[model samples]
Target: MQVVTTIAGSDSGGGAGIQADLKTFQELKVFGTSVITALTAQNTLGVSGVMPIEASFVEQQLQALLEDFSISAVKTGMLFSSAIIQTVAQMTANTKVPLIVDPVMIAKGGESLLRQDAIDAIINHLLPVATIVTPNIPEAETLTGKEINTLADIKEVAKLLLQTGVQCVIIKGGHLADRNFAIDYIFFKNGQSFSMQTPRIASKNTHGTGCTFSAAITAFLGSGLPIKEAIIEAKKFIQLAITYDLALGNGHGPTNHFAYQNYKETCEVIIHES
Candidate 1:
């Protein structure tokens, strides 16, 4: 089995961060490992607290994983401090494995996950080594210091991010105002790009959508899928997961990671009956 690692914070809510990443990786049929950079006391309603693990400990975890397991691909989310971000960047600098950088800056309840000062560290150190950088609309805006109001604006931000040395940039347009569908722009460093659209689901159970989406992409990449194909498959996986959310919590609930399997079985049954 392919082994993919997630270097991210632990979401006590089990709805996002490392919990969500591991769930998505497992659902996608990949072995998952994790290095917890921080822990959040949060649930569906909001984040109550955040405690960042020591940078040395984070590096130790990374070293242990790299020594014992052959990590095929890695995804990072919610690195809370600049020190942690720099440590992750340094440790992964020499590895040839594909790295998926999920620039998780804020939480579902509008809590800041990444430190404001750490953004520069991620842009200067982490992004240059990323195989793919996944950022939501606000994150892209923060990273590029620009306002995104249209597809053209998103493309321009993608170009600016590419100049930072990432191989591919995926700007998620989930936060677009007054949009009936969620559109995502995928831009490759070599000047190729495409857009994906899914009818926006009207549910509050989208707590971990970004983390799950990026984790799915990492799983596919670990399984040897091409970048574009991985993005497409990941997008489909998230759409299905969102479409069949469990609606567990009082606030923003978590996406159903197993929804894809349920979807596949339903399709198979329908095909057999037909």
Candidate 2:
């Protein structure tokens, strides 16, 4: 099995953050490895406390993994501060491996996972080196300084992010004008575009869709799939995850990661572009 590494925070909730990432990797048949940036006292209720792993320890964990694991690709989630962001960027700079950077700013239950000051650091240090940057509307607004209200807004947002040197950018359209359809646009730096549309399931069980999507991308890339194919595969995986999911927490419940098995027909994936 191909080895993939996730550099992120640990969620006690087993929903979003590193837990979801690892679960996505496992479900997709990748050997998962992780270097935790912080440990949080969190559940489906909310994040109670966050204890950051020191920069040295984070560095050691990453170095040890890269030294031994032959990581095929890497993904990042919650880096709590500018210093931690810089450390992660520096560590991955010379490695020249594919990286998926999820700009996780706010939790589903409205908690700050990233600091405001760290935005500039991620824009400067990490985005340029990212193979792809996945940002939801709020994060896209922060990165591009644009109001995302329409399809054109999403396209421009993708354009602005690509200017920062990211090879591909996906601007999630969940917060867009579409209320029933979940629309997300993936734009290559060269202006090629692929838009994914799915019926938005009206359930609160979408706790970790973003984390799972990006981790699926990393897993596909770790297995040597092309970028477009990886994203297409990841999107189909998330759609199934959201379809038959259980509403577990009082807050948004965890997505049913195994829902793919039931609807193999609808969940059937075409990795290459149709």
Candidate 3:
């Protein structure tokens, strides 16, 4: 089995962050390991508090995993502090494994997950080493210091991010205003670009969608899928997960991590019967 690691914060709510990443990895049939950079006291409603683990401990965890496990790919989310972000960038600097950086800045409940001061560290250090960086509109705006009210703006930001040395930039357009469709733009290092649009699902149960989407990409990459193919698969997976949302919490619930497998099985059965 392919082993994929998540270096992210722990979501006590089991809806996002490391919890969501591990759940997505397992649902995608990959073995998942994790290094908790921080812990959040949060639930469906909002984040109450956060406690970042020591940078040294985070480094130790990564070292242990790298020494023993044959990690195929890695994904990072919610590195809450500059110390954590710097540590992660340094440790992964030499690894050949694919790294997917989920630039998780704010939460669905309007809480800041990444410290404002740490944003520069991520852009300067982490982005250069990333195989792909997945950032939503707000994150892209924060990273590039530009407004993303239009597709052209997103494209320009992608270009700027590519100049920072990342192999690929995927700016998720889910947060775009006045749109019936959620469009995501992918800009490759080779000057290739494309946009994918899916009808925007109207639901509040999208608490962990970003983390889950990035984790799915990491899992597919660990299983040997190319970056574009992995992203395509991950997009489908998140769409189904959101479509089959569990509606667990009163406020912004979570996307169904198991929905992809269940939907695939259901489709197979229908095909066989027909």
Q: For all candidates, what are the clash counts?
A: 0, 0, 0
**Clash pairs detected, candidate 3:** none
Cα lDDT of model 2 by residue, 1-274, tens digit: 8999999999999998899998988888899999999998887778899898887899999999988978899999998889889999988877888999999988888889888899999999999889999999998998778988777788778888898899999887677766778877889987788778888778878887888889989999999999988888888888898888877878888987777556646764322221
Error at 221, model 1, angstroms: 0.4
Cα-lDDT of candidate 3: 0.90
Task: Give the RMSD in angstroms, all C-alphas superposed, for model 3.
Answer: 4.4
Q: Please give the RMSD to the true structure for each candidate, in Å.
A: 4.4, 2.0, 4.4
lDDT order of candidates, top first: 1, 3, 2
> Candidate 1: which stretches are off by over 4 Å?
264-274
Best by lDDT: 1
Better of 1 and 3 by lDDT: 1
Lowest lDDT sum, 10 consecutive residues, model 2, at 265-274
Stretches of model 2 off by over 4 angstroms after superposition: 261-264, 268-274
lDDT per residue as tens, model 1, 84-103: 99999988877889999999
How far residue 70's Cα lies from its native spot in candidate 2, in Å, is: 0.8
TM-score of each: 0.95, 0.95, 0.95
Q: Residue 22 of model 1: what lDDT? A: 95
